[model samples]
Target: MMITALANPKRFLDLSRTVSPWTCALAVILLGIGFYWSLFATPPDYQQGQSVKIMFVHVPAAWMGIFIYSMMAGASLVGLVFRHPLADVAAKSAAPLGAAFTALALLTGSLWGRPMWGTYWQWGDARLVSELILLFIYLGYIALWNAIDDPVRAAKAAAVLALVGAADVPVIHFSVDWWNTLHQPASILRLGGPTIDKAFLVPLLIMIVGYTFLFLWLLLLRMQTEILERRARSLMMARGA
Candidate 1:
């Protein structure tokens, strides 16, 4: 019922207008607090020395990469199954953001790895390889969407790819545990609770929250742009006819 109501473009636009500002504001405030706490307040790790600081930025980005891709896949499913008007737009708008976050994760991971593991890029690492593949999937999804000029066909094809590509998410998550990999196992989100110290954990959580809000803010804005572009296209078609 709720989904049916929101399937209308006008309702979706109004909702986007109402929600974007609050999300943007929260994102700014949380990121400010997180950065201050991470850079100034948190203690350095004894084992990792100063390199542990990279986790503040890298961890949230890595989380967002997977989170945003999952969101895209979910939206794609909704678009495919329910034929909701905004679902494909939401998925399309989210792809570049996911790709950006994924790239940031890889770049930051390499930076952290260089100091700790003696190498920036490890081809043998299962987790790293899986994450790299995730970036490629995001790129391919975006490409598939753009390659088709017909919007309906493009959405259908892209949604199928998104659904199929979602299989990689679990592999990416469990690569550390399932194989011998240099990437560390889940620390903050594990069955036995976080082994990380409180000083680092608190700020890290703040950053993660901030990153999440930032993704929402960006997604809403991108979706709004997609909506407007669609409207323009429709107007042009009407005029041409």
Candidate 2:
């Protein structure tokens, strides 16, 4: 009901203008605290030592990479099935952000792995390969949106691609469990609960929340821009016609 009401561009713009600033402030505050706590407050791991600190950044990024793509897939589905006006806009706005997070996850994971696994990247690793594939999927989605001139046709095609590529999200998530990999199994979210120590877990959780809010703030801003750009193009066409 609420979402339907906000589907109107004016209403969405109004709401986003009011909310984005607050979300941005919250993101900055929470991320600042999380980074500080993770860097200074937490104790070093017995084995990995300072290297374990990378988990604070790497884990949240990996989670967001999967999460944002999942969100895009859902939005794409809504746009395709129900023909929601803003759904495609929302999905399109998220692709670059998702790609960045996925790339960060891979980069940080590689940095962490070099010390632990004695290699920067392992091509044979399922988790690594699946995650890399996710980045490519994001890039492909972005490219598909740009390649087509018609907005409706582009949305439809991109939605289909998003739906098909969603298969990789699960593959990336379960890769560690399904196959032997250098990447560790789920520690923060699992059947038995987080395996990490309280000192590490607290900051990690904070960072995750911070990252989510950051994504929200950025998504809202991006969506607003997309709407305005489309409106501008429409206005120019009307005047020219």
Candidate 3:
């Protein structure tokens, strides 16, 4: 019922405009504080040296990559199941942001890997392979949307694929934990409050919050734009006759 109500594009756009400014403001502050503390306050890793600094950005990017895709899948599911209008918009709006985050994760991971692993790339690790696959899935979803001329068919098809790719997220997460991969094990989310020292952990957490808010900010913007574009098209078609 709630989702159906928000299916109206004008409502969604008005809500987005109402909320986006605050979200953007919060994102900037969080990212600023996060990076400042991460780079300056945290002690260098005894082993990885300043290189460990990358974790503050890398881990958060990776988390967002998985998180965004899951959101996309969930919204897509809602769209298909209840025929919720906003659900498809939310799912479609998430793709580019997910892709950007995935790309950031890959790039940062590679940067971190170069010094630590002695190579810029690795194919053997399950985590790495799965992440690469994630990037492809993001591209594929967007491509599918563009390929179809019919909006309803395109959204439904893309939703199905998004749901499928979203399933891969858990598999990727578990692959790292279950398999003997060259990638490092999870540290922050362990049974104990992060295994990391306070100085480093604080900034990493801040960055994660920053990145998450960043996505929300952008997602709202895109969703609003999509609403306006759709409305304009509707008006044009109505006038043409």
RMSD of 1: 3.6
Error of 1 at 224 (Å): 0.3
Candidate 3 at residue 226, lDDT?
80
TM values, all candidates = 0.90, 0.91, 0.89
Runs in model 3 with CA error above 4 Å?
A: 172-194
lDDT of 1 by residue, 1-241 (tens): 8788988889989988999999999999999999999988888777777778888988899889989988999999999999987889999999999999989988988887786666787655555557788899999999998999999999999999999989766766576446644544433221112387888889999999999999999999999999899999999999999
- Over 4 Å off in model 1, which ranges? 171-194
Cα distance off (Å), candidate 2, residue 218? 0.5
User: After aligning candidate 2 to the native by TM-score, how far in Å is the CA of 32 from where it should be?
Assistant: 0.5
Better of 1 and 3 by lDDT: 1
lDDT of 3 by residue, 128-205 (tens): 557787898999999999999887898899999988877776776677556634455433221112367776777888
